[model samples]
Target: MAFPFFGDDKSTIARLLSTLPQTGRIEWIGQRPVRREPLVAVLEAELKTDSHMLGDHARPKAGGKRQVTLIQHESLTAVSSFLGLDAPLDPGRLRRNLAVSGLNLLALKNRQIRIGEEVILDITGECHPCSRMEEVLGPGGYNAMRGQGGLTAHIAQGGIIRVGDVVRVLESATA
Candidate 1:
């Protein structure tokens, strides 16, 4: 069933398709109202509704668009670099729920991501830093975090998410 010019080598096509980015790892996990405290070893991302997640105190309305927040280790590093810092910035200071690695989070907008095995989240949009960034990261902090502030998402399915668990892309965003 292959096209004339394109070879019938199905294996090659399969490999090429599989190479698309679809997986990441949870590097750190934190919750608000408990900033700078020890991170939870395991995160239970229980979603009772589309806009609800366990352990999140913000508790936006039932249809909240930002049920959870996630940040990338790379973005943290970029901010630190922007500020002339010697080391990467601590993710806790950003007040995000999950600090993940190996995923281009900005590219995930409108996509569905599965954390661990069952927890599914819908990428809502870029998470812009509030004025608190200056208080947390010192001078020029707010500007440093401008485009590096990670992303916001809503829980689409309930499940437990643990540090070191794999985060997989379930569905990609359509144009």
Candidate 2:
């Protein structure tokens, strides 16, 4: 017999917690193969351990916290409205490396998220919109992206990430 205040049995708790991982789908993949140029959309990308996503223009730094950036596909509508536009914003215009749907990216901050079966990402911080937003999104674009920008993450466990792959929230933030 177990005490009531001791909480669930270990195995039961493990099963429940594992079932709680949030699920989403990768809608698009983009890479800036050349510096200062546009992000080229692709069907797949390679993620390397402790490095930036392969084929991307951004150089990997030792112990870098930002190896990749992602945006929520649903935020385009909100960003469009913020800019007083009738149409949704394009993901490419945002310059994010990944576009995802069905999960709140912000809620994953400081958490460990997994893509597909092997690729794991540690959400480090927000992917703040840069001044380039003004150049690509027109006047007031910088402000329009405030709070609409997505999440930045580093490669926790590297592997291939493909379009249409599932994005799973494997664990909550430790701190």
Candidate 3:
């Protein structure tokens, strides 16, 4: 869908923002079996429409906007650098459901994206870091994840999503 543009300059920028041709790959998938527990890395998982991942502990109500969470693979590296770590931060430590690579996930806000062949997610908002980061990633973890926390989404369509699945934007939000 086309976003309304008020002026020529704004229209150009909007068009540019809407044209995201780069596809991403799901590099990792993690599911939290219980609240406050470490996420378990998995090769694949089932998404429940308007609910949550089948194996995840989250039981958000139907149509809940934060049913799922994703983090950019590149952001993992950035967070590691911020923490002065020798290795990239583990996706599980960040508490995100999926770790995607090759696309700027921040650019996907308010858009719908398809993962693999069937699962579709409506990008809802930023997944801000919580105090748990301090416990998981060490002292400065919370601050290091400030802007790199990633995204929250609701399942628009349901299906199995696997690691190595291709991720593509399906539609942009209309203004």
Candidate 4:
């Protein structure tokens, strides 16, 4: 899909995107992801930090900037299976820098995803993919994670990220 989006010889992709600005740009922030994790609050209270509207209490300050991660809705669906039938993965649990609906997650790599009035995340690299996904998802939870999940990006500018905020992708050279 991205190949069709950036083909130099074909300007149609750009034109299509220009016409469909709102197709995949806006998504309602339903829930936080990590809040579903049992004992996550015990492990770290950063979830309650004022700087973090979701669960980013322990953002790195010495490294230069904090990291942001975004998980796909498909992955979110996968997460639901891991979560108990009684309790769903909280929207706040995933702690996605930007919870999106229409755009392709893979296509946004290395791009700047703008959230809120001042927050900008410099998608640095894939956040450390962990077995915690399996712990939460259970059973083939490990297999469900075979190449489908979330991503990690660094926060270029730090600010409060909350639910109901709009996200904009500031496309870069690679995007």
- List of clashing residue pairs for candidate 3: none
Query: How well does each candidate superpose onto the true structure, as a TM-score?
Result: 0.79, 0.85, 0.93, 0.59
For residues 1-175, what per-residue lDDT tens digits would candidate 2 score against the true structure?
Answer: 8754357588766555445456999999999999888889999999899898888989779678888999999988988898899999878889999999988888788778889999999989999999999999999999999998999888878999999999988755534
Could you list the CA RMSD of all candidates, in the order they appear?
Answer: 5.9, 5.3, 4.0, 6.7
Clashes of 1: 0
Question: lDDT tens string, model 4, 74-99?
Answer: 55565666543444454344544444
Which portions of model 2 show Cα errors greater than 4 Å? 1-21, 172-175
Better of 2 and 4 by lDDT: 2
Model 4: how far is 17 from its true place, Å? 11
Error of 1 at 129 (Å): 1.2
**Which residue pairs does candidate 1 place in steric collision?**
none
Give per-candidate clash totals. 0, 0, 0, 16
Model 4, poorest ten-residue lDDT window? 41-50
Q: What local distance difference test score does each model get?
A: 0.77, 0.87, 0.93, 0.50
Cα-based lDDT at residue 29, candidate 3: 99
Better of 2 and 3 by lDDT: 3
Q: lDDT by residue for model 3 over 1-175, one digit each (tens)?
A: 6546545687688787898999999999999999999999999999999899999998999978899999999999999999999999889999999999999999999999999999999999999999988999999999999999999999989999999999999765722
